[model samples]
Target: MTAILITGGARGIGRATAILAGARGWSVAINYVGNEAAAQETLEAVRAAGGQALALRGDVSVELDVLALFDAVQAAFGGLDGVVVNAGIVAPSMPLAEMELDRLRRMFEVNVLGAYLCARQAARVLSRDRGGRGGSIVLVSSAAARLGSPFEFVDYAGSKAALDTLAIGLSKELAGGGVRVNAVRPGLIETELHASGGEPRRAQRLGAGTPMRRPGRPEEVAEAIVWLLSEAASYTTGAILDVAGGR
Candidate 1:
């Protein structure tokens, strides 16, 4: 059986991905930071769909935690067939000049270093199948990376832009190794990501800015992620699938 690992799987997009992947017959290992209840809920939801799933707790920014999470998955499922590096954080909105240095550091810790650590470790375990074999790595990014969100939060946008480069570079480096690295850049997903912008009204403003005139559901982004991680994207790599709904 193909096994997959999804970080931040307690709720929102991560939970959606875990459930969908389970429905598609993949063994799922969900890694959440501190929400046992939500993680267990996801585990139950996936299992109820006639799929197998396990929940593990870990802070993705810590190397040891990430290593242990993968170790557990390796022990439970043998080896991972795919991974989604989706765990991250967004600090309260502030311009570079006004943003607190410590706040920016915290965001970078989770958004940039966390992804780097996860991908680095996952790459070590998942390599090319010389005889036509390999797995997939899907990184969750944001459309704000391109738009810059100057008036709102540039720090978060900058961090995601760094992730974009990480996906692109790793894609090239891992191509020969048979592992495909790609990213999903969502526009304005209804996920609580916007609440961190220091304004509960930010999500509404974003929705108004989008052509779709509504925020995207977590399930919508999960659909794109499941596709990229599946055999359907056999020939795809180093690509960013935009789930922004006409941003």
Candidate 2:
């Protein structure tokens, strides 16, 4: 059976992806930094849907945690077919000058470093049996990387921009190995990141600014991620599927 690992799978887009992947017959490993209860809830949802699922706790920013999480998934599933690098952190929203250096660094630690670490691990585990058979890596980026929410969260945007380049470069590097690397850039999703920034209504404002006039749902983003990992997108790699609703 195909196995998939999704980081930050306890809530929001990550959680939705885990559920969707499970429904599609992929044995899943849901990794969460904290909030074991929520992770368990997600685990139950996957189980209820008749998919084999496991919940693991780890901080994606830390190398040890990333390694352990992958090892655990490997142990449970025998091998990995794809990975969704959806774990990310957004520091308090503020202007560039006013944002604390530590906060900015933390965002990079998770958003940038974490993604590279996961990609490196996936590279090691995936195989190259033929010209078109290999694992897939999907990084969760933000449209803010291009839109540049200057006054609100420049640090977050910069981190996501780095991820975009990471996806492109790795896509080229791994193409010969038969592995596919790509990204999904979500525009304005109603997720916990906004709540942590002290503005639950931020999604509303962002939706207003978007041409769609409504924020995208977490499931919408999750569906895009699952599609990129599926066989239907076999010829797709180094591609960034923008789920921005034309933002």
TM-score for each model: 0.95, 0.96
lDDT score, residue 19, model 2?
Answer: 88
Q: Tell me how far the alpha carbon of residue 128 in candidate 1 is from the true structure, in angstroms, after superposition.
A: 3.2
lDDT digits (tens) for residues 25-142 of candidate 1: 7899999988899999999999987678999999988999999998999899978889999998887776788988788888899999999999998788888643323699999999
TM-score of 1: 0.95
lDDT of 2 by residue, 1-247 (tens): 7799999999999999988988887898999887999999999988777678999998988999989998999899987889999898776678999987789788889888888898888877774743223789999999999988898888899999988998899999888887899999998899988988778878888798778889899999999999998888899999988998889
Q: Best candidate per TM-score, number?
A: 2
lDDT of 1 at 243: 92
Instruction: Write out the backbone clash pairs for model 1.
Output: 128-177
